[model samples]
Target: MTSTQEEKAEIILNLINKRKTVPKGVIYHDYNDADGSIKMQELQFLISLLEERGLIILKGASRDPILTITEEGLNFPGFEKQREIDAIAERKKEEREKLEIKNLKGSVFQVKYWWVILLLNSIISFLIAYLTKS
Candidate 1:
């Protein structure tokens, strides 16, 4: 990793490691302090760094849309906050899936349009030939 990336990872690790408990949202568990795993915008970047460095693992959370860390991920050197990092990883994956689904829908619509055009052309040609011959 580059020096800049390593530095950012350190920042994220420190913030998450300090958490005594986990609550909800992207803020601190205490709910008073602003300190947390990352600044709102940096959450995605932090997750990428964690995965790229093999600092965290992801497991499925009880909730359908959430993910938790698996048993295999106990602790990783350099990155101390496993859960926070895993959360980041899961969030990024969700975002990627959403975009892929959107693209798939668009592709399906394009294919459908092409098929409809072909069908219409064949029908028109058939009708014209039959009428002209008659």
Candidate 2:
């Protein structure tokens, strides 16, 4: 699923929080993939957004760029709480799907065995009736 810009911002905050000093190259490496990379323009857009919002600041030399989060960024939109909630919901959804698959398999197995038992019973009854009649 494509993540929203809000989610991307949250991810940026998380990276900043963890590393304390993040470089531009690291963000590009982490966010991009075979599916697609976040456009350089997009990353620059977000950086500008954060800077405008006073959440982060560009630091270090221009040649050796880094980012430093402000106090506001540390507590950006209560991200830690939301991240935890999202994680919990994802785990629960996975567990629920696993349980549903397990139940479906169990039901299929039971139906298969039930038909076998039913066929055997019918055959046994027919054999018993024929023998008695004879």
On TM-score, the candidate that comes out on top is 2
Candidate 1 TM-score to native: 0.30
Over the full model, what C-alpha lDDT does candidate 1 score relative to the true structure?
0.53
Which clashing pairs does model 2 show? none
Each prediction's TM-score versus the true structure:
0.30, 0.49
Local distance difference test values of all predictions, in order: 0.53, 0.78
Q: Across residues 63-130, which tens digit of lDDT does each residue of candidate 2 receive?
A: 54698889978867654566788899999999999999999999999987997989999999999999
Off by over 4 Å in 1: 20-41, 58-134
Which residue pairs show backbone clashes in model 1? none
